[model samples]
Target: MELQKTSNGHHDLSPDRIPENGSPVTRFDALENITEGDTFLPNKSNGKIETQFTDFVGKTSFGMSIFNLSNAILGSGILGLAYAMANTGIILFVLLLTSMAILSAYSIHLLLKSAGVVGIRAYEQLGNRAFGRPGKILAASIITLNNIGAMSSYLFIVKIELPHIIQGLLPDNSDYWFVDGRYLIIIISVLVILPLALMKRLGYLGYTSGFSLSCMVFFLISVIYKKFVTECPEEHSYNKTVPTESIYNSTDGMCEAKLITINPQTAFTIPIIAFAFVCHPEVLPIYTELKNPSKKRMQKVANISILTMFVMYLVTAIFGYLTFYGNVKSELLEMYSKKDTLMLCVRLAVLIAVTLTVPVVLFPIRRAVLQLLFPDKPFHWVRHISIAVCLLFLVNLLVIFVPNIRDIFGFIGATSAPSLIFILPGIFYICIVPEEQEPLKSRPKIQAIAFVTLGFIFMIMSITFIIIEWVTGKKTSGGH
Candidate 1:
């Protein structure tokens, strides 16, 4: 037994006594008996520790993890993807999105490879392995700011979309606060999200994950219907669908159709797409709960989730963009006329999907906060509830102030998301898992170094461009 210090004071943190039943996360043996020069894992025969999520151990399956991770990856950020496509244009939008998805998958590979190399699974722990305490804090902070920005995006969707849906359903309503976005978000947090957040284990959330993804699929189907089947008003409706050739042949309505246009506004695509694919923070926890956690098995889970989300993103963006063409709004559904029954149905479905996802996003944010504040503390109801309330309050506060999702997604995606997706993973992989003794001369290390350097450049350019757009008062268009 080792006495782990907590706000409540020193408590026994026995190596084999994890709350997650039937788990073999006995690595705490190293923590309990750590010597000055002890390797993070003692007597390592192989570079792996089979992880079971500390609270939900042995209860999640490979398929369950995939659905949950897919839910995490495909967030309200998808709402703005049509906007991204509009800005980047059709050809470039598809290319950029595809590239970002590939890079995101590669980054996850690096993260998992590094985890296997060092016998660690947690994102913060990977940082600790690479650069000690500061690295851990850095990782925690990135995840914190990134998630807060993301949570705010979710609530931002709720704030903007829910009111529109309610008003659309009852157009004659004259009540102000009755349909106010801030109050509606408060209601949602208290009712829908609070119960899910309060749950002690992640395994139970899987059932909800299925429902959540289904809602998004319904939303996707609705978009396709509105584009091809749902009758559009004369102003918003197209006589014919925009063909691939017109995009290939022209550049007006086919804006951003060029291989790559160098507009500052479209540069925001890096973050939006980055934000769309950011389930990295949740991957390890999901991996821990995987039925037979291994680098190969977990990597497979990651691939399937990413690939599935890529398809969803591509389909949703194309159909939504085709429906509105150059006029696609940041929130795709917002682009549709309010009275259309099919559009209303689409809006309602999306509202439900994003609403259910709030707690899923909250789970990792709470975990990161707890790990940072009370690394060794047992999960206490008081602490858990307090943190959950604080996150809800804090995120909602940001949501209230932030004008829209694009700015939120653009800012966080440019600054924090690149680090989470590209820079940090690259640095951690190079530092922790040196594939060659002279990693300085090693091909893998060189590639990682290039990747991190590119990530920084990408982040810097994105922020600079977004700021320029703000200064110039230029509006961004949407895409792929």
Candidate 2:
């Protein structure tokens, strides 16, 4: 594959050919040339390219795009925010959250600028453009790992929450097979998730994503409601055994909110924030589907979506932390009394939301794997079904053996989240943006270099701290 020069003198890695009409080409021209494994190549057989921009025109409106991007931003990570706030105090948590939100928006700006320059909308295509096939594989692999971590976290939620929900709804509180979380996760994966994942297309899942967002809204409202009605030193139950240090005897210092906190556990704070703000993978797809796509317009959609999620995340963390303070569990829903009627409803809604979302998250991981392993192969039912099954099976095993959900949030957030939100965008911008437009020492390129450096530092520091904690046998339940 040779690099083709665009009319503007920018080198385009896209395989799109020019139309006979001699009009300017857009990213849509590249979309026309997408091949198996999400890679593209020039169609040498036909000397002329087809103009199909009208077919995709005006398909997605601005309001709808905002909704979709918001849905992508929100995930199981919200359940961990209160725990994050507990480790870091209110002021520090808010500062970190605000910075992450702004940084996420800025990274999206970088991505949009790079994509526009190369006339390539796909994330992996941008990788290919920037650093060739190895870059493409690296991008796909990080996406796969990031999303597998997402799926594992979702299933982990199901493992912890589903049984309590089942036990709550039953007549007898005695131990039963139906109330075993491991068994329930496996069963649900087979019965519910597998079938949905096997489908050829997921246009219908958009409705489910909207429903999930609604459920999260209810969850936020419930958290806020509990803050007013529930007081400190209140009765809270733990589903798992906790250490003596975890128990609170008085409301004296425990309930008092701190302005800032310094502890080993605080290392997980930024990663958790990173995990919550990762909607980058979905951003370009939303841009592609937008009615009138432009770098500025899509940036607006991203900003609105990130700002809305930022508010939601901050409010949820504050209320949830205030309601339980230092006693809150990593999984916020687990900290409440299992018999609480309102909480049961919240658990059911959360279970439904996360369960349905696993298949959606699985789609990207499967695509990345296929793109890497089966790049040139045509669609085959056997391959599709096999990959979905293997992924679910692996995630189920991960959920069953993992000691707690915090590890998932910490490790995944430390690794994949930074790569997606910081490292990749920074590299793409630095490499794909022509030096003529922005010189090596220019503000944008220097900022991009610093951004990549920051990502590497964060990843190394977080991982080192987590490993030290594990080695010292300091692993505990909840955020700490």
In candidate 1, how many Å is residue 59 off? 2.0
- Candidate models: Cα lDDT each: 0.71, 0.73
Best by TM-score: 1
What are the RMSD figures for all models against the true structure?
6.7, 7.1
lDDT of 1 by residue, 235-324 (tens): 543212423233344454432233333443466565666556878888876765677567788889899999999999999988877677
- Least accurate stretch of 10 residues (summed lDDT) in model 2? 238-247
Q: How does residue 413 of candidate 2 score in lDDT?
A: 55
Off by over 4 Å in 2: 1-64, 173-175, 198-203, 234-252, 376-386, 400-413, 476-480
Candidate 1 Cα outliers beyond 4 Å, as residue runs: 1-57, 230-265, 401-410, 434-438, 477-480
* Candidate that scores best on lDDT: 2
